[model samples]
Target: MELTVLGDNAAQNSAGGGCSAGSCGSTDHQVSHLPDHIREKVENHPCYSEKAHHYFARMHVAVAPACNIQCHYCNRKYDCANESRPGVVSEVLTPAQAVKKTMVVAANIPQMTVLGIAGPGDPLANPEKTFETFRELSEKAPDIKLCVSTNGLALPDAVEELAKHNIDHVTITINCVDPEVGAKIYPWIFWNNRRIKGVKAAKILIEQQQKGLEMLVARGILVKVNSVLIPGVNDEHLKEVSRIVKAKGAFLHNVMPLIAEAEHGTFYGVMGQRGPSPEELSELQDACAGDMNMMRHCRQCRADAVGMLGEDRGDEFTMDKIETMEIDYEEAMVKRARVHAAIAETLAADHAKVSAPVMTVAAGTRPVQMAVATSGSGVINQHFGHAKEFLVYEASPNGVRFIGHRKTDQYCIGDDTCGEKESSLTTTIRALEGCEAVLCSKIGFEPWDLLEAAGIQPNGEHAMESIEEAVAAVYLEMAKAGKLEQAVITAAA
Candidate 1:
């Protein structure tokens, strides 16, 4: 294991290199808090920066299909296209194939900046295929930021190789530090040519994870810790995990919900281990926020996911499609550079023009949750009828925070009499049950009335406006008009 430092030339030429200050977005408070060096690493990396997710896109190549640890929450499924979760991919590619797909995605999706290898299995467990892909990408696509997500069972050994390829970002899924709680989440781990099960395995895995985290941080590589919040399993235990990882110098902490739906067929899912409720997850994140930066916008993306967060475009660049289509790496890289520059310019302009509203709310006003319909780019531009999902935000006098998103059936299918329109609208409203307001570009008369009747305000006044600003402005309006107090009392009643 030979450690190497990222060169100055590579840093300057990386995809995030040339972006102006505030180019990521207006709500980039996490990035703003970072020191200049670490800030440069995450300002344009979509997964690392919540605000950058709107402007930049990331893709994961599924080249590693081997695992060293067995987690109760994960069941890696290949050829699983319909499911959108970690460890699920339609296909696994060889190192060469992964590089080719990376090139094609970069060429096609100009906003794509970060290329990660978060597998159908662990990248560090399959070090040969993993590092080979990274080696090639660093040579061919040096401008694209490279990252890897591992279970950390093999991370201590891979850190040197990771740094050798100029890979600056690493994600370690550290579910629990206590072996007792860990034994509940991970059943077995293959270590030292033998299968270790139960508490012994959990202890080794935890030790490796903590050591790898410290090793990566010592080398100046940005580390983001991902924890799955299982209701009875590790919910309360993750706070200590967060505190420990932050103490080890992890740059960010992402506390994601466990996807234990029985349909996924994992051990937890089949055994009726339920995931945390949205409220529970939010409370845990808030608790951990006192320790370090909490990542709220994770989509728990697939191994081969393409495009932005909350969206997948992997179907467009399948192996068959890549074989048929011709790609000119040099030319595409030039075009990508230009597109990134243009995006930075646009974001800078948007930030300068739209100042965040100042809200003078009465004391003790509860935070209001609002849903915004947006196709992408962090604006309230999507029409109500056209939205397949609504981005939910919680606005307080402190600031606006993206809590989660609610998926709903599309309301306005092209005019086929809309036979199921009423049912769809009902379901959509039900999905947005807690939200007090829905902001979008337009809403029809019928749905508008229905939303109002349900105590959810439908407002189209802030079309094409920044989502954070619009949410805050709406909250201020509600506070000024005495709606906040009434809503709280009504809910109480």
Candidate 2:
């Protein structure tokens, strides 16, 4: 198979080129984190600032109903009035209908400060539908902040498109970074026109997630990571999730317990996989306090959730009201499509110069394994502790061939940011034991020493290079330093 690798620099340079006026990659948060200035900006966003919950309100319009992946805990077709979880929207509207509903809701509830799309499906999956809605809102209701919640599989490619529409806040549902746990939570993901199952799917999903988060942060987008705390699965791992995303510059972390109600017709619910208790959830949030800010006011909202945090105004703006409401659909569609096409054209022209790298890895004299922490643009970019997975390649006399990856557990244990504790630290070292060398953007002294103590060469000083570029450099250096031959002898020992 031929190799195609998009360069890392293209992503960093391509951001914010088409953002709407006055919001060219600017964040609303102030210098002092959640101080008065920041609060005023986020005072109406119920999900981001805790103090905004009581007086502020938010609304989600479920315009995108097509999904690309299947979550074991989600059933999009089944919506119970008694149940409240993701994929349960009372009504799904078109881009035109959504804007009309937003107008009605905003007028009815003056407290509404933000408009979001947390889908009956992945918003990024239905990009045209989702962006069209944003285009209309940006022209009509520019004052209200626009937010979106996505699974992150398509986010890496969609960041430029999102910034073009001036999307201010984004929420990514990052359940777990470890694919062993991820394989249990997600059944399959449809990618590259194929349905990839098991750990392979999980790894691809994770790499895109970490990469997208980094790109969004670089573009000054306020990111909120939502982790569903599944008891006996990933409850204990969430604090580490918090640490890693915080390290990567996520603005906020919202850890919500899994809502596994049997009436919702979910796979986990049928299997009796229970959600964390209130106490269990609270303790996990408390454990993540010092390492990152935790959002305690999440109501585990539905896709069509409306009104304040605890209340529901979805019934007030139902399809009946939207039909009765007068709107210029033809004009709205024309404006939405016109702006969208123009921005897309400008973005295309701006990125027309970016090209993919001719990636290749040569064979070495002796067999050895190498790993890299990447943002999936084929470059070493992510911090050691924040790496979602390490791409492992086997170099032998025949040739260097793609092998597999080890989903690294986010390195911090409990509340320890530096990873000084021996237990979680030992687990990480053991996972990468036989690798001769590992390429990373940065690592702390304790973990660096730990890898060297285990005889794995830690190459923390390597500058940003593509996976092919880094592998070639490392292979040649190993050959010159006689490390590959020594590795062979050590294996014979």
Candidate 3:
């Protein structure tokens, strides 16, 4: 829990004086830096563009239940409603059922602009079901952006078919380019109608992944490379993975931490393998971000995730529920067009506003961490007592970069007694241990006083303001008041 200061001269230069390289900032600023074609693809994609996540939503349908390879970190589970990781879905569906559910979701949730098929299993492994869902959706819900995630063993073979269905965004999980390191992660692969094990299997998977990446890039498909940082296994090796994928025309790199909880029942989890700490993950991302756009807002969403990132509405649209709900997709598409247009107009206006002031820290000023309570849309609009989680960001001379989120119990339950409120507030304060400030729409005086006692400042002045701007404003205010220098001294003591 040491403070990792970002936005130094090097980071600012690499990030073009905006946010950290490939991290959060104003949507207009981030998009303007990309090539015209790439910008068009990511401008409204919630997962691809950090800024757009505030206003957009993405969902995945679990139609592909057959995987070709085995990863120690992955445990595909069906009928699991409590777990929120990848490869877990409540119920598997047919292509027709997937399309019906998607239309219902889109009609009800206008913010949903992207539909991805990242499965309880690899999409390409079950070609017919995956493509059938894509083909039908492409013909029916043409307005929704189509995306798929794969392990890439079958990608080269599926590329031609993928293009026919108009899939523009693809995510390939390329953990390692070296088969030696890969052998430790993947145990086996079902290739050529046989089970290939150990290093041989790893080699084939890597070759297929690299080949598939090249082919997808050649076809003008936007590719996002996802690597899981296994603490002792591929943690140090992922730097090489990032460089290799970026050289092959990958548009973005997402270095996600391994999820190795023992209860998940994965090989790594049961064997006591550990995931990276938040600080460790952030440092690795900073290292790999020298010239690559690193995605920092990914939620590692489930195969059947719905609604905005960090919030799931899958339960509301189960197969049984879809059976009863009526959907008017034609009218829904019209409304979706209007909603997208308004979002575009708002982003244009936001882009026109003067950019947030870029400050330079004096030699000894330490970076500070701040927590923001937002209900998505990149604005600090959630009330302090009502928030179940707070998105944490680090502010320094370099810029504001989202690090991760901390979960806590909501403090203001209407029926809570005084002792219960105090306990909840205590839990919240403990959850925000490293943050120097909390930014929310509103906070009660009692919690504010307690936060100050714990050396965390409480600020509600930036309600509804962009999170990055408000973070910068708070940092500048603290610096001008000499609180930053005092903080450094206080920490040293």
TM-score per prediction, in order, is 0.89, 0.60, 0.90
Best by lDDT: 3
Off by over 4 Å in 3: 1-28, 77-79, 360-364, 407-431, 445-450, 486-493
| Candidate 2 per-residue lDDT over residues 1-493, each given as its tens digit | 1111111123422432321111111111111234343344554477875434534678999999999999988987686554456788777899998988887776666567789998999999999999999999999876668999999999999999999998868999998888998899899999999999999999999889999998998887778899998998888778778878877878677888777766556888778999775447656765664455566557766788888665567887897976786755445545544543554354334235322222232343666678777653335776787665576655554334333345454223354432345665676677675687888999888888988888888887664765545665677777777765543553443
lDDT of 1 by residue, 27-125 (tens): 554565466787778878889887788889999999999999999988865234456779988888999999999999999998999999998899999
Model 2 regions lying over 4 Å from their true place: 1-32, 35-40, 326-493
Residue-by-residue lDDT tens digits, candidate 3, 1-493: 1111122225354544333545544334455677677788889999888778889988899999999999998886523455667888889999999999999999999988999999889999999999999999999999999999999999999999999998999999999999999999999999999999999999999999999999998888889999999999999999999878887888788899887766667899889998887778888887877656687778887899998886889999999999999989999999999999999888878777765447666756778999999998778999999887898988877667677777674312444331144477899999898898999999999999999999899999999998888998999899888888844544444
Candidate 3 global lDDT: 0.84
What's the distance in Å from true for residue 64, model 1? 0.9
Backbone clashes, candidate 3? 2
* Count of backbone clashes, every candidate in sequence: 0, 0, 2
By lDDT, the candidates rank as 3, 1, 2
Distance from true location, Cα of 275 in model 2, Å: 0.9
Residue 485 CA error for candidate 2 (Å)? 69
Q: How far does residue 481 in candidate 1 sit from its true spot (Å)? A: 2.4
